[model samples]
Target chain A: MPMTRLYVSVLLIAVLLGNNACTHYYYAPNTLQTPFLQEQHDARASLGMISGDEFNGYEVHAAYSPLKHAAVMVNHFQVSSGSGSNVSSSEDSGAGHLTEVALGGYYPVGKYTTFSLFAGWGAGSVSNNFDFDVKADLSFQRRFLQPTVAIRGKWARFGAALRFNQLRYVKGEVDVEVGEPDLTIIRNIERASPLFVPEAGLSCGFGYQAFWADFNLNFCNIRDRDDYHFAYSTVGLSFSCQLDYFWRER
Target chain B: MEKLRIALPLFGLLLLAAACNKKADFNYYYYEPADYALISQHLNLPEIPDDYRAQLPTHIANLGLAARPVEQDKAILGRVLFYDKSLSKDGTISCASCHKQELAFSDNAKVSTGVFNRAGDRNSIALGSVLNFSAYYGTDLFGPSGVPFFWDNRAGTATEQNLASMTNPKEMDMSHSDIVSAVQSKAYYAPLFKMAFGSEQINSERVSDAIAEFVNAIGSYKSKFDKEAEKAIGYNVYSNNEYKSFSGFTAQENAGKNLFLANCASCHSPTQSRPAKMKANNGLDIATTDAGVGGITGVSADQGTFKVPLLRNIEITAPYMHDGRFATLEEVVEHYNSGIQAHPNLSEELRAPGGGPLRLNLSENDKKALVAFLKTLTDTELIADTRFSNPFK
Candidate 1:
């Protein structure tokens, strides 16, 4: 009887915590694109949920159903720091890439549409940029066409998406012109706060599912420049997997 | 009844529209100009000239200034840039390395020093009357506001003048990128770049203008001679004939001043003078290793010629003459006094026959008073002005 009471109390506590903890709060401005519902491939692949019978080189679709349609989905990024760049050198970041860990949760309201918001932080030496809060913005994924092949038990979906992001450097404000203009002195200047830069990106991903779990992966261009993606786009790829326990209700 | 029902539906739709239009929660970001230190003092000459507006286009056409206008923020940014040694190959020297404010903005050494302590062949001249100097030769795309800078009339425009130091190999010894890194690293200058040029990127013309503004800021108008001339003081000593005449004068000093007016004024007139303001080729050396003006223009008539220097703070800018050949003002005066050499294209003022009319010979007393008068031209207040002190320390 005591263990039964403890079990009920533990479940109640989990439900309370799950309800109160701020899942990555994302701000979905009306201008954001709608998430593609038919794009189940990315939603599943991000969680690395693929069936044993799945084949390589062939795009696949995956599905995930939760008791509550508005539950938040988060992404984790492992990030690092301490890799200072050579300010005078025109070189690329060749050091062993550091992991910037991040945790973000976004919400989806329907099968064909999703308006998700997330606030996460990533810090690595390669970032080189100053940060206000390792953060991200809302992404609207819409499933224009849901590719469905003859499935055995679980259903699947696949498509692409458009994302809008913001990068900030408010913590780096600097005082530039405060000092006296004495050309006679050399080396330093007036000080001020650090600088902040804003950026945008475009992405496409796929997903898969099985009796046990669901997974997905997404590749995107994450630069803030207007036409920086004109020639060769820098890519950001995310991989994720979720437990099959959430599907027990089915 | 049907018409009333349709109208009521439209009213309901309008009401819903207004409800949706109500304000929602939001966040935003804003930027403000970053502050910086002024390492050198400036005199803010001639209101930047009304025509200075015209100089903007040529500057914008260049890749550097196209990023920012020649406006206030850039002027301030240029001040800091003028003093940053990181803009050089080695961080020891900077734009202010040679153009010191205490020395009338000119270097105190004979030949200007550069990175690695490499010395230039010519003396570093003070920065003033730049807008009033000679014009350009049109070898490249020059700017509206330009002037003659070096001993030779080499650089034609302010833009060119700004670029000269980078290429000189002895001065700044840097490309635009190195300066950009040095500036952007300050943690403070990133915003200053935005304040001055509205961007966080740095370039050369901006570097030149900042230095130029600080340079133009210091002037010789505060001299006792200038202050008295401006009526700030009572009818001063220079206004009296007793001072200029033989009354208690060093005979050599009077002779030197007379010789100066007759032979040197053609080019090296006081800053207050106008027109072909002054360019000279004193019959100093017959066969010259330093080609002077001729080296710049490739003209035979200009051989061994050099810009006649302003005599404002000549005492401190010593190691006199273009090559800094004379260590003392006495040696310089005596060079023309009895040692005028014969050259094929020497100035007629010094080359007149009859033993070259050695008329500059004077009693020692004459030399003393003249030196004293020249001393009065030195604005001691300028050298000690705290406004131009180093900002780093």
Candidate 2:
């Protein structure tokens, strides 16, 4: 790497290591349904809870399929974690939160046992408030495209996906009010070139009903620069209910 | 049924958000007025009896260098800050880590270690005798001779010197803002700061000033040499060549004292007011890697010159010299005896009649006498003084 890139990588790693709550490693799952030939319109809504070290979150998602081969989806998520304390009081605990909204679509490639491709764009903000009156805010926007393939058996469904993501924008601002004059530090964070992430999971249906629960695990690879890299796995469980309105028979 | 499905998740999310809405209830500026009185008691600061202050020897004052009076409250505050480990970035090192009272406020190690056990380049210098050090250099109580501190003498005053060490990346590894933030975050510092600076607001200047006052207040006059010199007539005189042999000294010690007066008194003056302000190369090495004071001044002629420290507690502050190469007083005396090199910047006092390095040509007996005489300068009372001990329990 060039000297500038090396310096940037060192600084990025230091920042990430210093404020661990800001380094997120999870993204929303895509394409919940297996490919099936149908002429009617269908929509599904899901709510999921995910928990991990330094992270706990809830997500609300809704998807509508206008045609059997195409669907559009929207997801909203809020996550929070404790960043520890620097002061004596229990009230002086440091904490951080992240909120994101994403819009995406998916295309199915087969019937019964099927394959599909999906893409999404997202925007989010992360903020951490520390003891001694220190605060940091980071805003980011990203785009991702992925290819997914799934097989719908009689009782269960299994699927895997690989995503390529590009972070288009990132900005950070830090405020420190401990000293007399107070200070505000701002920086424009450069986005990493691109990242590749792979995810796989299994979903089992309990009964023959529109409502079903599924467990999905996502493996995320995040590299902010040439030398800074972070990887983690996130597991989520969700219950969804689907509704269908027949327009024309297949 | 569809409404319930949408309402359940939203309600759960609302509950989760409510659970996460934790606001810390701490006031950074909270301090009780009563805490001010409790600081000295809790830290066990020694109360300076009026008699102790009055009885302090006037030998330093007799040298035309006025004493820098130390206030009780300011020195107490300084004592706390000096030992507080929070001053460092990692809270693992403090001013006391390298400067221990047992070793005359100097470390026994060849090189002192700082935060993360990182070894510094130069040996730690003793700060215990800085009270007389100021008088020797004819500086104010804060040691601002326009000359610097440390082996390199890079800082102008004691406070500036301390600030440099606190922020040095290899030492405390803290920024100026970091020091202030750490001190302000602690509950104990509020009362101390208010007492020292008339306000609870802590700053770098006040912090350094308090530490400088504390260090400058660490003087020792109860040495064997002081007691013996007090009886000798004209002992307090500052004449260039005036030498009064002490009647109280032993035969061997007096012999060593005479030898020191003839050979070493020019640079390492027996009196408090030393005439030499600039450092000398001392011919420690032919081509010195550590440029000493010359590195700070950027003068090639000043290369290898280092500020000679006062030898008030020479016995306890062993592993002597800037790099701590001499492990014993005997080795130190041997260095000046036959080990002086022909460096271009060697002090003229250490040169022979032919203009090369002077070989003292002392026998083993004379070398022993000089070592014994140097031990007489040790101030046993200063090392065990509770006033300079660590305030923290």
Candidate 3:
């Protein structure tokens, strides 16, 4: 019953935040990964649904502890307004894809507590189309360094994370025919290339033995935000599976 | 494990290659090289003079006229739109067809010929009448100057005014859809649109906005009168009072100017800034035949009242008045001197104390001097500036 309620709540938020028209978000904050690895060969994989102000989609994340006090992670995400839609056919629509890889380390401070840090790089493309032919298509790369704290119990776990990210617009073509504020927004994004974006995340999960339902919410902070038209926050829910066969015997 | 490691790095390289930068590239994805070369040879964006981007003219500044700042890209787009004949049905007319650059942006005819050689009802308004367009029509419909567009002030903003002209049966005779299609069909305009706006999307609002910006960027305040006025008041003094005659003017010109200041400066400002009056019935007829502003408002009091135009560039923009009844400045001056009619809605300024027309029955030389002074209001540079010239070969 509780799981059903959580799914319903996530669906409601996604619907409410979908299809923000005539806006081009330069960056969409992804949920910070805080895998709390405690031993070698411990692994966790998750698939989540994402709800953003201008984009709604899904993401997949996997983390593995290769060595004691050392771990690696990979994340992939795809977002769009609708399936098989472009600006030519729709009043407002867009699609985007990103994948990142990272390596980090963790220290178990207590029986139920762990602290970790991760650094990663990601590449992606984002596009927005409105007013029939006015569109912004951009290929971008993001670099991030994150710090996290986690608490674990037998069947439940919680984590907090802060990720400092810098997004660089690598290249792409933009055709815009809008005026004023919308035009100004595109110019500002171009002017602010290699933009510094910072985000905070809170994640929690409840589960049985090796499977869990995870929920996460992230918020990004940008200066002079009113001049920018983009999603600053994202909420996600995911199903996570864990494998610790190597750590179980140890 | 070795194959996986090789594939992972290769995949990363591929992703990075796919995301390679192409920032600010406006060329078409298919035939970009040929299109870029053609457009480059044909259309060179104007290098707007520093004088235009500099501080407003002293007289205009004194009135605190709210004019839009010159945006280089948008202005270029506007210039292209102003000259493109495709905006009209049958491709026979453009805004420039009537608002010619040579004649101070006013046609030589009594009334301009439009699409299919249709005669328009009113004279083509001179765009160079003020320091700039925003100074004349202002930024909005009910802006600081309260200036509306058209001879009758029927349209509000420059966008509305241009749209009305484009759609008018006797003018461009093109619908909004037709306008978009015409603009979209032109391959050359795509690059210009990308330069002005961030893309090649041709739509009516963007079209009108670009044209308005271009029109607003028109006008040069470097007239002889402007130079003398600045010298008289010095720079940034805000007031042209205390000085009665321009030092640069001849005795006859000064005499004519004094007469103008006393008789005509109220409606057409001496400083050439915002005028004190908007529309007035200068007793054009004993009865309102065309009705003018009254026709739009259905107001009896507004009968025969036409917009009071700035006298700047009056030397070239002849065939004057709303109906272009006066062919020359002499006729215009003579009408004011001896031909004001005793109409019911004749402006109070034109009313004699005896409740009839007032006439400044000046001598012929005085009339000649007045015309000479009016000629000083012309800005020679504006008529021939290449920045405003047609880009088409």
Candidate 4:
């Protein structure tokens, strides 16, 4: 774990990604251990990138395990991809980026192989959307040969995600006059969502990487979240590497 | 930033749990006393001047220990609650609107007027001697072992009495939450509530206690018959011309008394000096607007058993009996002498001896005497007693 390389890697995504690097799992109460299983903790982070002006954005995440195979995390995201180039490039303002606090949990399955299924659920409010919902993200990740100083840059990932958002409202049902009777009702609506949101894609990168990273270009279904039946798929790259100072060999 | 946000919400949860616990405490604190003493406390507790125990002694001994210890503040708060108009839907009428003190704690007229000027179905009973009717023989007249109050005897105790009349559609029609809010918001009610409940917040139980306290305080009896009984009744010699010149009297009032005793006293004993409390089918010529006490208890035996009222103010509070059909005292007495209607459950005491209708051989003179005695039972001190006057005034 080299300080110069980790800093350089972080800076590279922040500056070159054009307002698209995101941080995750900071606000959620990720379980640091599995109560019933051996108190083993698991955490993860991911980054991606791609070539020239096709699509843009980046995401970084972290998690804690407190129960068997489950983790909670808080996340930050900045996505610049859009379905239509006309709407994507012309009307593009930085308003779509969001910073949110959520309570999320996930399960890791299949311990024998390097391959594992990733599934997670969470609820939280995004600064951009006043409403909220139950959200889910699923992915498949695998590390080929264990990273030694020599075989460090070996990894592959495949994943799909489905998320729901909610919106709420309120009304008054009591009279406001004298101690006399009031007759009113308050109405509330919470988290508006488009059911069946889907994100399916994969990434393969090479590197016996220590201060190393990879890029993933995935496809997302906009119609999975709303009624207008919009489609938003992206091809982009992300890079992730171990941070210095916190890096140590046991 | 994530750490700060998470900690803040956890704090909010702790506060919410504490608030919920306080609310639950209130629910648990009420309704549980080691020994049941409140029932008796509420039954005989009074707030006025005394020397007037009347049948209360016998009634209390009969009441004998089936009560819980209601707090003292409960009584004071209850009196104010009983008088406050906020108990009505329109906030226009309180319990006092119908249980006016001058009318022996009863609302006069055939039916009481309620919220929105709606008239009730039957005559309201005098709350005065209501506690006295808490028991019958050895058991309560209301439940399997309780007593009854009101002309219809619908409610069991002063508590039920306070409640039924308050919620009757034509009466107060108050909701519990609304009534609590009303009582809590009044300027003087806060301290009153705190004094009674150790807290100013009003709930249904406290509200019931306050009203019950007021009812408990409003007892009746301190009349001539009562005073006459303390010593030797024959000792207190009568010298008034009304009784002295009894032979020369012409007003049928003199005849009404003798006629009343001979024909009406079988059930209405000389002790009460009123007609019997039996639900006798009076020989009336037409159908009644009310089925009398029978309407409440649903018993065929009670078909016409209107409570034998104390006959305290027969003149001022006119339109007598459960229904206001009789209009005047003359009509009520005349019904007994000749107008009993034919009903299967009519009282045997009402049956004229020797088999036919219990017709009184009252001439016009006798009818007048009976009316006279009925009027004599109307004690002047009671009608004008200032203690029972409108508390608001």
What TM-score does chain A reach in every model? 0.32, 0.64, 0.87, 0.41
Order the candidates by lDDT, highest first — what do you get?
3, 2, 4, 1
* lDDT (tens digit, per residue) of candidate 2 on B211-260: 87676677767788877766653553334466556777888888788788
Global Cα RMSD, each model: 19.6, 22.3, 9.7, 23.4
Which tens-of-lDDT digit does each residue in A67-145 have in candidate 1? 2221112222222112213322322111112111111222344444454322222222112212221121111111111
Instruction: Rank candidates by TM-score, best first.
Output: 3, 2, 1, 4
Question: Considering only N, C-alpha and C atoms within 3 Å, which residue pairs clash in candidate 2?
Answer: A91-B24, B148-B155
lDDT for each residue of candidate 3 in A50-166, tens digit (9 for 90 to 100):
878756789899998766776778999887764326556757677788899876667789799989877778889877665556566777787777889998888899999998877
Show where candidate 3 strays beyond 4 Å.
Answer: A1-24, A53-55, A80-96, A108-112, A172-176, A244-250, B1-103, B106-256, B262-311, B314-372, B379-388
lDDT of 1 by residue, B214-307 (tens): 4444444445444433442232223223334333334554454544444455565432323134355777887666778888778887787787
**lDDT of all the models against the reference?**
0.42, 0.61, 0.77, 0.44
Question: Model 2 in CAPRI terms: which quality?
Answer: incorrect
B158 Cα displacement, candidate 1 (Å): 3.0
Q: Taking the tens digit of each residue's C-alpha lDDT, what string does model 2 give over A1-250? A: 6998588546534432343353322233332322221222566677766544445566666666554445555666665555443333322223333333222334444554555554555566555454433454455454555456665544455656665554432554444222222121222132232233344434433323456565555655453321322225445566766555223333
Summarize candidate 4's per-residue lDDT along B207-257 as a digit string, tens digits: 876777555545444543344333323431232223322333344544554
Deviation in Å, model 3, residue A77 alpha carbon = 2.8
Error of 3 at B140 (Å): 19
Which candidate achieves the best TM-score against the true structure? 3
Fold similarity of candidate 3's chain A to the true chain A, as a TM-score: 0.87
Fraction of the true interface contacts (Cα pairs closer than 8 Å across chains) found in each model: 0.00, 0.00, 0.05, 0.00
